[model samples]
Target: MSDEEWERFLRETVKDTTGAPVEPSARAREVARRLREHPRQAEGWRTYSPARPRRRKVWYVTGLVALVALLVALFPQQIVGWFGGDDGGQDGAPLAAESEAPREAPDAEPDLRPTLAEPFRGSPAARWADGAAGITVPPAKATGWMNAAQVERALKQSRDFLVAAGLDSDVLRGERPTKAIALLNPHQKDVQDYLRTALSSKKPDPDTDPLLLFSRFRPEQTRLVGDVVKTRGRLTYREGKRGAVEVTADVTFVYPVTPAADSGRDAEVIRTIVRRKVVMSWDDPAKVITEPGTMSLVSYALDMTNGGCSGPTGYFVPPFGTADEQSTDDDRLIDPYDRSKPVDANDGTTSADDDCATATRS
Candidate 1:
């Protein structure tokens, strides 16, 4: 209520970083007077330091907001509320924190950076649906070899594989792709075995890199920002060369991840985009002894953006700030987000080890 109380409060509450008691200075007295004289002037408390670095400013604003809340709670009687008069809000709603708001200073830009709460804010994936919903199937039509219903079944099965391979939480966290492989016809043991070895190997070679078929992250190194994995792409079907209906899935999956749970609140969010072109055949029962409801693998291709090249070759390693994609004299940088055209399949290179391209964004 009086100068004596204010001084006593400062002596008890305030401290320097070194833990030394901080006696309120003349500037603190002036700032206190201004806060008391004009309550709305409390809005000016946001303007902490004009020349501080952007991140420091964020921390400063956050500190100021927390301090205000503490003061309001601890000294509701003594501290004339800077937000309102001696009487608080009618409903007694607690004060809101403008914690991370940029101070009102020159070059004080708002933190438009992506965060765990809004991982895909500035990305095209923001508009995409989460997981398999984005892989839209075309209206089923009778292919030359199969009926409309068979074609639709093939498309749905193809989508299931996509979901398991890329969107499954267990698969993404570097687990086995059992669900994805189950969709395959058991007769195609060679293909299934190839996939198994691709994952079973601790370190894969160029042709057997499991990332080409599955989206996986090293759990010890990084973790998903949230449970959401935004996806967008299409599914189509046509007559296959082997007298079967071939369903093709062309889809892009975007994942936002951070260094690990221990990484602080402001940890950088790395966006890794994986695009796959998977073809599955609805085999002709008359010609082949196929399972009643199974799709056989025809062929597939993979393209990725922002997955670093130098990490363990088995899984996709999304780097902290920028992509660590390796470039060779024969390889070129490509836009991972640009799905305007199909990947140049004729290049004959099989893996990132053979034809790694640096990404523009990560």
Candidate 2:
């Protein structure tokens, strides 16, 4: 082709491939200037044989293909940008090179630590203000028959005291009920003796503590954990041969299970619901009764672990009760009445009573 026509063709090709104005290479511009300055040499190229021209055309096409392949390999992202793709690269820089550039600093992250609620500081029967794991106190009933506030107070006090004594771990592990036993009302001597015997025994003995035998039947590697999530219930006053007030509560506790040694799995948390009953009596006949009057715990009972009360693991022994009547194998009463036992003057007047007695009375 003529020199002028060749130059125009090269310009158009460059513009089409790069989507930009053609800026001819120095060599190309020099060649064009030489051709323009030398008319005789340009004429000779135009007058070449037809077969020779075809051969030259073939070489030109091959060279053009190689140039295009090289440009595609080196400037792929630039080519993509030319086609409106987001390489975010400038001046034909490779995508990888652009990615290596320093980035702008990111904004600081917000704080995300969990905040713990303050623990209960008021009376025990008052609402438990601080409950973890989404636990909440149920609404109090308006009926004044039973002292709901007193019951709540008792439950909170018992739960907190038990937890502090490590009841969840120590009692289940057959360790001595050191801290927890102190909270038991003195009226529950039989129950106390039974628990002490069970904890002290090296092996399950049927004679000392019959209930010890059932410890073997408990689920292996399973133990009680967690705290009281919520409490709800009502109290009823009974006026009969033996006058007393009773409080029944539905208590929820959580337990976390460790993964089995052989199983490659995550640990799980399980919830257990226990029905607790507390009975209070004012032995003094002359004292006038009030909503939250002076009353002593006489009997306490917690439902058995399994479905029915038939299990060897008798229901949770109340903070007060005679072991003979409430814990025997044959006679298992949820709320038994045995007034024969001397009432524990939980009042501070008696040093023989448990220290918790003073706290409970207050």
Candidate 3:
């Protein structure tokens, strides 16, 4: 065919394959001229060559690889999640966003020991008692006889008696009424008998015997005298089943605990000043008994740092000695009323010695 006819034929063939009319651009015309010049070679194009197919396949594979790499970089977490690997974030969440999420905080510890307030005397007494001794002078009549000075004197007498008796003040410091009663028995036979009979009764009540109130309550285990900072007393007369004059003493002191007891549990040792009330009843205003007994133990109450009072455990009785003889193993007992002489320890042996002799009783 002629050059012009050959170009027209090629354009028509391309238009048929592409389904569009071909424009004769410079490049298209040049390609057409080359095909026309190589007619013998063009005849071979009728049979397909693997060269074009191979090149197309190579480009397709390269594009697919680039797409996969982009997906891996952008959705690493999501890819891991699909394959059952830990994605860190919750289900279906993006890793970048989940990484910046805020976390919840843990709970705090609670306070075990709380702060306690100082004790006061005006507070209600812990224990009270009405002895077997009949009330010859009832509370109403005894009011005229009782005064602050008289009550103060009575309290001092009681303090002196305790110190003189060499009573285990530590045991008395606790709440044990029975132990206290036993300790007082040798000294105050009348008081001891009264307490035993009253406390052992089937219907023992604080109302009947005020000292029974300590059955459930007690002061802290500590030194009572050494802690005493101040002491004051007042006389009160209240009418009840039996009339009696009441002498109340308020003692203020610094509550102390052993260094070992106050360790890491508390940052610093806290010694609090507290006040306690001691009440005693006088059944007969006419009779002049010893200091503490003249005013019987009616009520004794105090505040404790740790908690309630633990009653008396036991008492230590010191051995007695005389100029004529050596010391004996037998415990020297004394009458709470008369400290001048030493009595038997309920055991039959009674050996009076110089140790039992003291100027206070004389």
Candidate 4:
């Protein structure tokens, strides 16, 4: 056959889809050359281009290493954490708000020691209202025979007398309680004559002493620590079976005193706790011919804590800081600040019972 006829026959017999010249691999040529080698193997043309030379694996390894380096540069902290290095923080480890040293817990106990400036600091009286404001009177209602207005007037008069007798600065400074005395009925000559003798007398009896009627401190000796006085109590009133209105006041007074106001702050200040319960009687004007708006003193109960046992009845001398703190040998534990206890009448009031006892607190 001619060369052109042979090429046309090859093209027609074995088609080349790429439109390029057809070629054979060495394996295919060898297979065709050696018919006896293997007759069962399959054969087919895969591509039209010539095979490329293989590249080394070193380039692939280098590319992978570069990718890892780029990631570490961008996220340094995350990279360090993966490697478990530098505690996963900048410079060193992470810091807390207070990283210097562990601090100790603070003390829980309160400082109770009294000072001239803070006399009521540790005592229960610290929370009490100051002066006359502390004396709280209940709402005046019509009690039995007395009208509401009369009841209110009687309550006010009772509170005024209490303020004069116990809370008045002048009375506390060894001055007579004229305001308190004027509130009492002049018909109470026994109570009046007794008060007159008690105030002037040098060695008065404890039960009927001037101190029983009022509170007084020697101006020559100790002085008040601060301008304010702490007080707390309640006033109550009721009409009795005899048709007379009875008004009573129960109050607690806290007086902080030092040798003098000029004394140093560190100097020990003494606290005098006095609880007084005074009874005032109002006779009905229609039934009895008595003074108008005047109430007579029926009876009273006074209790003082921390006063000197042997001191004279009229003046108060509180135990000194330099002396033994546990001066009272009596085991009778009494909380002077506790107003819940019943009012003590004749114990500390009578001359024979001039004794001291252990106090639970200042």
Candidate 5:
């Protein structure tokens, strides 16, 4: 691994091992700089001061006065013997009274020393610094696709925020607005087309009945909590300019749902199957990684398996797809219109397949 990669790995490893997140302290940095500049003295010596008298008594007052007089009078050695100062004035005789000027108060203690060990710098993943939640805003100005990833992440965050505010769950699906509108307004041709493809695509078998089939969907209600970005691209000065790009998504949001009547059963089943939800968000290639050679486009797929609405789920939807797919029990697949001929299993059915020459077309 490169040095940067190694550093990042080390940082992440440390962060994981220690639950406490390491933060950069300006004070720490400054202290470190000072330590490097002015290291600790080799002597490592410290001086002791006499404790101040809490309450003065007649004897204490008299003794203090006598000691001061002796110290000033060039009899410091005698005074040391009389008191408890070991080797007091041993280094040198008290400066001649005339030459000894009052000492200025010792310089205030320097700021506390910084840590001896290296400062702990967290990894980029652990270093995600979100702004105060709920106070985020749209970009102040359009900076072009240079920050496209940031924009998409921001849009998702915004969708989450709106959902938390009780706007609509479908909006956060990251599909397109048309598909979102179609979910509620199936009468629209766009909505009809989506329903036809999603719901009418297939049919179920004779004995078993199921609840839902289309597996992927975007929650209608969600909100954005925070965002940050790292980029390696040229900032646009005018209308059009482009260069290398790198973007990341950092977001957090909440989804509200009423408690299921049979929480245990729902949990078990939801965890087992994946369901689909509609979305109305956009994707910016600069911010998202995708297969090579595919131009950015609306509509995508999501695997809801493990814990979707009813069970683990997954499916593909076009830009304006709807939420009208049928649900069934078991794995039978049949014609959506006739419900007679078997087409596939688990997946939904659609209109007759007239394109097939060998098999009877629907």
Candidate 6:
């Protein structure tokens, strides 16, 4: 085709691709027309035009080729990935495998030892409700005065005693009337330390009163089954010339697990501090029974003979002041895993000495 025709064709094609007409300068168009008009002159066109150096063209071509090569090199894996290849292993699953096999939920921490519970003292409802608030007096251990049938009769008669004494009807309605000892604030360390100290010794002081054992709700072990937890406990009381004394206030505490705080540590803090206050209260000499014989009896009741140490296991006990008895939700509640070995409570498996004593001795 003629150079002018070729130029017009180029213009139309450019317009089609770029949507704009290609325009050659007037001088360039005239030159292209003259060259095309003379075949001989067109043949000598390269000589007159003085072609660019071969090295420059080579460099330009090399630069374009290198650019294309670089693009391919940079995304070789991506190119292969478009066609589906192992090199790009379906969305970096290989990279994930190379990094670390998903950190397994860091080995779960070993659970803490489960605590035991105190026996239920009063009616089921009463034991669950006024657990640590009910009053207890020394029970006359006069077996000769009562049999099963007579005890049932006494319990029926006790309803009048309960009303006169301002006790709850639930406490008197049961076949057996139970006395409860509720401790305000008993020290945990003092109770544990006292038990360890007293139990280690065979001959306790006649003048020294027995240590009173009391139990309260531990938030860590407790669960919010419904609105309230059913707690059961036993308190060893003794009487003397002084007054009624709580020799041992060992009770099972049942309460809801207060939810965790926003920081996730509130539950832990509550469980640790709640029982501590109760333990410290029992340490106070002024509030505790001071009669020598009564104290001795309290101590003996908590002694190994009574099997008091082998009480409740894994009972839910939340500390007081954790929450109003009305609040319900597990949002901030503290829950603890039970590590207490399954026990045959029927076979007196509660004795910690029975379980761990051999381990310690060996």
Count clashing residue pairs per candidate. 0, 4, 13, 0, 49, 39
lDDT of 6 by residue, 1-362 (tens): 99999999988887788666679999999999987897563445455666677798789999999997886688765555455442312121111111112222112222232121211111122113332233232243423223345333332232222222123233212111223212222233443354444334433332221222222222333332223223222233223323332233322232223332222323232221111001111122454533211112222121111111222231222332433132223333221111122112211112221221101000
Tell me each candidate's RMSD, in Å, in order: 26.5, 26.3, 28.7, 21.6, 36.3, 27.2
Clashing pairs in 1: none
What range of 10 consecutive residues in model 2 has the weakest lDDT sum?
353-362
- TM-score, prediction 4: 0.65
The sequence of per-residue lDDT tens digits that candidate 5 reaches over residues 1-362 is 89999999989887787676588699998999999999975643485557786675878999989889878587655556455442321222222211111234111222221111100011111111122222223332334453545544434443342233222333323333343232232323443454444433343221111112222233332212112211100111212223222221112211112122323322211111111121222333455443222222122222221122222122222112122233333343321112122222222222111111110101
lDDT, each prediction: 0.72, 0.35, 0.34, 0.71, 0.29, 0.29
- Cα deviation at 118, candidate 4, in Å, is 1.3
Cα miss at 203, model 2 (Å)? Answer: 5.6
- Model 2's lDDT to the true fold? 0.35
Give the Cα-based TM-score of candidate 5 against the true structure.
0.22
Give the winner by lDDT: 2 or 3: 2
Candidate 3 lDDT: 0.34
* Worst-scoring 10-residue span by lDDT in model 1: 100-109
What TM-score does each of the candidates earn? 0.65, 0.31, 0.26, 0.65, 0.22, 0.20
Predict model 5's lDDT versus the native.
Answer: 0.29
Tens digits of per-residue lDDT, candidate 2, 45-129, equal 4576554457888899999999988987987866664665522212322222111112332122122211112111111211221
lDDT of 1 by residue, 1-362 (tens): 89999999888775545686679999999999987898763336557645656898889999999998898798764455345332321122222221222233112112346677778755545545677777788888898677788777777878888998999999888999888878878888767676777878998877678887789988988899888887777887788866888887778888888887656877888788887887788888787667877878777787777677774478777767654747656556666666665854411127744557766553
Model 5 alpha-carbon miss at residue 173, Å: 15
Give candidate 6's error at residue 329 in angstroms. 35
Candidate 4 residue spans exceeding 4 A from truth: 1-111, 323-330, 346-355
Model 3 spans > 4 angstroms off: 1-155, 158-244, 260-268, 272-274, 285-293, 307-362
